[model samples]
Target: MANVVVLLLSSYTSRLATSVLLFISVAHTQNTVVFQPSFLTATGPKTAALLLGNTSDISLYLRTVSPSSETGSIGPPSCVAEVTQWVLTREQVGKSAVRVRLSLDKNLRLCGQNETDADCCPKPLCVLETLQVSACVGGTPQASLLIQATIHALLVPSTAGSDNKTVIPNQVYQTLGSCPCDLTFGACDVRCCCDKDCSTETLKLFASHCLLGPFGGQVSPAPDYQCSVQSAEDSSDWFPFLCVQSPPENNPYLGLFYQGKTIATKRGPSFQRPILSAPLPDNVYLQGSPIFTVNDRYFTIPQKVLGRCVTNAPVAFLKNFEVECVTLLHSCPAGAPLQTLPKDLTVKVKNGQGGDAEVDVIEEVATDLSRFISSTDAVASSDERLACENVTLALDYKFYWKGNSITRISVTRTVGTISLNVALTTRYSAVFLNGEFAGEPNSGNPGYQVGLPVIAGIVDMLENDTGSIQRTSINLWKPVGDGFCSTAEKKPVLFGENSTSGCLLPVSGQNLTQCDLLRETVTSLQAALITATYVAKSGNPDYLTMTDWVNISYVTLNSSTSMDNNTSSCYGIPSHQHIHVWSLITSTVDGIPQRDIRAVQVSYSPSTWALDCGGGDVSSCVDPMETQLFPITSSVTFTDIPINTGPPKTRFQINFTEYDCNRNDVCWPELAFPITKYYTGEPYSQSLAKGLILVFFFVTASILGTPWRQIRQAWSCAAL
Candidate 1:
């Protein structure tokens, strides 16, 4: 009978252990198996309460992360709130759970006194009324989780036989699933938590249309916990492209917190280049030369489209721009068609000069360049072919010279029928000498004529092509004939002249544009020159130019005269000027290096005077009668332009620091992509984080293959 009793006791103990193990395992699996809910979401502050179910009784716990004396509830939210971690107490702890009513004093839901401020959340000696508790004890963990459930008081008796003995096993949680979208913690409501508006269909459609996802917090549909979407401005402060900070708002109830990275799209500081570097289509000239309206009164080249991959070019390629004659004319004559200038015709250059050189530095340019440059009729033979008769030939040169001199300077232009030469001569000479290149004593010698070749090509094109001069860049090389040895930086002193006028465009349109207006063409050219000067004078590497464009503003003569360390053979003369000249070229969009264009030409005179000429003639100067120039030209094109895109937007990511329950440390796994709906038709269901953590732990335990039931039975028997 004694042996039988012992065996029966053993069997009973085993059954008891099995029951306990099964119950614990099932509860653990159902409660904390995965730290995440089936569907995870976010909400804004005002609607944060909606994330919770009205029928369910849920309690929240907070543990401060950052050091802040102010303690209060997360209410009256205007933006977003970031918290350290949170814990949850559900109404499911059996009889002990009944004692767990929210402590009004320590709940934090009601305001309390703060250390620095009177209006703060108050603390209590015994804030919690429940006997059974899962407490968070110590230092910060990588991750923590909050689990919730509905409890019924007096469901079961206490497990302790007597005075205050705790016996419940600690539950651990793992993460499972994550949401695809971002959720605002305080902006959600139960009514809209999983509503049609919050459905995946709507989000996907929005993403496709606006190229950005709506805020994550607009999921909850509960009245008090309803969520509202926050605008992009709410994510950060002014200058979103620069600094980032925490959202300025209170925390929302039952919402998510996340940090992460995502793909972004933005406009490049410069333009894009095509892979196939080519030139604009050759003009089909009616005779030997390009077709013109008034027999050289104006010249026009058929507008053409360039491709991508033609990297490293300037914007001056389209310096002399204009509309096709047919596009502007009321009608074309049958036999001898007359091309007319368009009232609103303008000029444009792709990669004016160094556009291609700086191509590699730009992050990304628009691939679909067709949007920037387009033409309706392109077929050459078809009647749809645009007659480029309204083309304008913007001039780029102005010559100046002194009076009463044999050496003359003038501007000569020759297009198809428009060919003329203008001579600029001085009427008087302040300083003059017979036929010698030397000027009079203290007077300035003026010349009969001075030649300016900067705008020579432009004038020629206009004279021969019947083109209009809507815009142009003319350089004036002030040949300071060596005589006045004044050591001073000489910037052009615009007395009675306009420095910003001429063929340059004004600064009014977008990226220097004005509804295809001829006036805009000139203003843009001027703007390009100013841009180039800014770059050269500032000495910023980001603004270095590789190609000289149409508007070659001025060659900065940077001279340095510093004392040298060696003074051995230096007799007494002061310092010598070490001068270097950098040609400043400007395009509509400055700083570009190379580009596709009809033609490119440059003419400049070589240095005429040597510093140490013959025998110590230190005061010698350059002869005003001598001047030379060399000209060169290159043609280019662009082939394939890519497509257009928008800005960048990213979603939040949740990371699991670790799995811990002691001292109520919540281990929340970072949420993955968001889900559309989260209604489980039950209260106390695991959240996305809690569910995932619990699931991980459950799987781990299963993999361990330990006989938990047998272990529990043996332990129970021993205790008995």
Candidate 2:
């Protein structure tokens, strides 16, 4: 999974207003404070201090009590209006700027989940609200105030015994004051002090000096506990850390003039490293490219949190202050394709019985061949009457065809005793040829040196019992030679326990025999032509790649044999039936039939053979004999059933009969390999060939066509 990122921005402002009333020979400062015009609640009806700033970098600090004091009915009896204040701050050369704003905590309102009353219930938990104060300035030495602020009762409540108390419940609060002494622009100190224990001596001094006479009486005394409050809406209230210049200006030092500040740019003060910051802008890390080619939208803010309070203008006494925005963005990365393992293989075998038999046969051949002998030659005879007794036979043979040619042979056999009318086993005569052991004579032909090794069984049935004799049941062992078992006169050979390593059909059972040692290996050389076609149709190599194609060849690639010699190209024997299989991965699900595909061609040549014979003693020597080889000139094409289109489930039906070139007497219901494809997603769907039948044929044709094209071109030129 990938990740995503984003950005946001946050800023705020604060301001104050005031007035002086002269009546009956008295002059007094009557400060009315109001917050901004945009806030989530009302800010009024509470007691607070009204501090005024003057031009000498000084602030005239004063305290004012609300008309409805602690003993009063909470507010001005008949006046529901909020008292707005003009904030005045002294600038250089006796100039002062006046701005309007609401007071702190007292200007806030309350809320309840179920309360519907306009003044009391169902209020906003927190909202940005504002109030504009009427502008006013002081009569004394004044300075133009570039910025102003109104602090009110929304401040955290002071302990009851202390002056740190608030009139409104659940309201945010703040306060306003200036540097008590000469100070730099960002060096003012602010604090919240509990005024519960005002000294009588202090009150007496103020009254004697007439400082407390302006309000017509001695006012409530202030407290001594103090803390700093964060005004929610002030960018300067919190010193900024890193400031990115707005449009029309490219550098922070440029004083709103689109150029660098003369003094700050070249002087030592430079720019004060900002101490606070606003929030980030929005949509900074979204993916724009390879679309827009650039990502420039972003911002960053810094902040400190003190207990539950926060500050834009944080005081040195504050240990923790928090900065935050209403919304934030999360960052993430890009997308890419995922790789996974393939599903279960769709393997299949044409004949379940034969397939299992073949596996067992191969295992035996690769493992133990001597034990395979008894199981092969154990087929029961057709007409041996059952006498409730067992029958057995044994025969042995020796062939001396030393140079891969014709040679003489000898054989012998012994049969167990048995009654003729019952389950009979006969003793067999062992003939001798020139003082050498010959095979047992059968009723059909005497002393026929056939290789049917008998191990203790019936010798002769009768004249009419030629059924058993003709079927090679009678033993007549012989030797291996070129002319011994010629095409015109085929002979049976005992090929069970006595043979080197081969298949055998026992007389005790009806199982088919397997020839193990006599086998061929091949390579699929023409797979390139076949695979390119598949690649054009499928993008992924796993589906139809040449590497996955099963290669079928009659000759192993790196075997030690000449192209025209025996042991090469089907051992240079044109008469030998050599075949290759391009197996198909089939769905093993039941009820699917095999589909017919392409036809295979077997090409031949009698020019590929060599033989030699000689003795190291120089006593004898023999010339080589002839051998033939089959070569294919053209490839075949297999067209079968259509493939499945959708996912989750699919079935396949293949017909081997459509692919078979030779129609033999092998009997079965039919011959085909059936399978199904299991699909999980749209892109993984695939269509494979039916089986080895048609595929091999098409491959052979393709290999042959290449040379044929050149030959045809040459012939055409000669004729011209």
Candidate 3:
């Protein structure tokens, strides 16, 4: 009996292996059926009808192929297959014969027992392995087509290392759901009525206030003239006669004809270059190419555009530029990193083989940290908050390059103490030098040019050594559009343009204190104006002379009290100042004009009201506390003057003769000066000859008048 059982088991195993091999062979031999024009028009006997066989065989095949173990009895198939049909119509060529084409739809339905409810059967119980499609003419079958179904299943491993694992089968179908706009998970969004997190009580607060009237705040569709119609106010009178009748599944292009063949179009090249995210070991640098650091990141610098600060602006190779931005520094220790410049720079240089090679250069940045609090110190250590007011924040970078590659770099940073909510100007400038010695830029060629900033410097006269003077660039008041008479930024004055800017000076305190502070502030502002200054004789500093400076003359009202009210006269404050700049244009012998600022005059005008006590004493004035605005204006004028080509001559001596031009009989005193021509010949002889001719014409005109006519009349009478 044991021998017989062993032989039987061996035979069963062999049959099972043969069946598995047969299934694989059938799957491979089945060709993919692709519908095409040739397949329908080929010369062959046409099929009249197509039908699918019973699906019970497919369920039995799946059960035979499934694995079983000794731990459990053989179970029914997990899925049962259902048939899907597709019908097609075909026409025979050059004949009045109607043919039928048939194909098995790839999608199949499966039904199975539900795990949650033993009695319930859910869809997708079994996967289809193979199906038979029969071609029949009337009731008799002519031929049959075998179709192997492709099964897609997701296998999930059993956690207990057992055979009890799940396989999820997927099918192709259309699905519908509500629009998803509430992206946030736990929290209820404001004005988002569709958010599930919004409870009934919370939704009631903003249900009607939704931005898009609920519906997940989705945008509404635009009005369509063909599909949308205006409804009448009274529903009883509304009619659909003029409304468009469209079906739910209407095709927009139905019944339209398409003629021309489709020609594929290729896109044009893009102007933007790809930014490098990783550093290149050795690469050539090009203009406007993104710069990279040694680390795998693009090099970025802080920049500002349209009054907004951008911290991640990528640095471009071989591009020299500057930017000014306003930033708020809250605390000293927190803003220390911003005050330091970038120290590591990755540059490209020319190699021995004439190719560009990239190298990393680390330089020490000049940093000033005395103004900021140390990171180790506590914020409450100081009594007063350390705030940098009206301080300059500058970042300067100098690059040394050979040909198109940079060889070296230098960076400098000058920052002030960080403050809370303070708007500070951050300036960045870059200079590229081909060689060590680079000359400074001039404002113009030979003289000051219009639209260019004026070159002005403060002159400090040495008291002991009167002949020596020290000159340094001075900052002038520049309007920053904050407010009238408010804090301003210092900038150089531009030539040839007239500008008026003012700032508010606060005068708040007791009577005496307000008066003193107001006077002091006015004095300081007036003193800060560029008065006695040294300027370059020409735009180019190479031609500067010792006497290149000019003193500013102040024009004031002829009053006993000074403009600053120094004598306590209680006079009105000089709140308005106008500076008049005069440029002298000297013409050379060749007629080339040379311009230089020869005179600068400033005038002061008092305000309408005086800040003084009723007794005319400014020291005791305490009427009100207010802020005063002081306006300063500057204008430029150009004068043309001839250059003295010859040696200096004495002034022309003239004898004055008193004559009354009011009397008709008396002739006015001869007041004429000789014209000194620069390029023309003498004109005295021509003038005298013309005067003699004019005298002769005058006498002829007199003779031709009354006296000559009377003499002729008397002679005629004596002859008669």
Q: Report the number of the highest-TM-score candidate.
A: 3
Task: Put down candidate 1 lDDT per residue, 1-720, tens digits, no spaces.
Answer: 111100000011101221111111112211121111211111101001111112123233333222225763222211122242223234432321211221122122223334554333234221222111112213212112221221211222335466867654322211121222324454422323222335565545444233122222232222222122212212322232343333324323222322222225455544563244564333222112322222222323233236221211221211322222112222332321122222222222111121211111111222332322223323234443433221222211111213321122112111111111211111111111234332211100110011211111122235455532222222322223331212111222111122211111112212212222422332232222222221111111111132312333332222342323221111112111111122222221211222112222222112211123347542322332222211111111112222233443223322322432222345243133121123343311234446678779988887565777678778999999
* Candidate 3 per-residue C-alpha lDDT over 1-720 given as tens digits, one digit per residue, 9 for 90 to 100: 111100000011101321111111111112121111111111111122211222111211111222247644333323432334333344332121122353333332222334454322244322333333333433333333333333332233444486877643221111122225576789888778767788999989987676442245332222232232222111122233444556423424211123232445556556654453663335345555665544435656666656676766766665666777655555543342254433323444343123443643333322554423323323533433466432436656676666445666655656454555444556676666668743234555577676666665554456665453343333356656664444565555566666665665544323323454555566567657654456665555532345666665778655675545432233445666666667766432112345777776667766533443446544434434432333543333434445565666334222222343333445333333222222134434345556678779989988998989999999999999
> For each candidate, what is the lDDT?
0.24, 0.24, 0.46
Please tell me which predicted candidate would have the highest lDDT against the true structure. Answer: 3
Pick out the ten consecutive residues of candidate 2 with the lowest summed lDDT.
356-365
Candidate 3: residue 7 Cα off by (Å):
68
Model 3 / residue 539 / CA error / Å:
1.4
The TM-scores of all predictions, comma-separated, are 0.15, 0.13, 0.36
lDDT of 2 by residue, 88-142 (tens): 2322321221222223332234444465655432333332233322223443322
RMSD of 1: 44.3
For model 3, what is the alpha-carbon lDDT of residue 59? 14
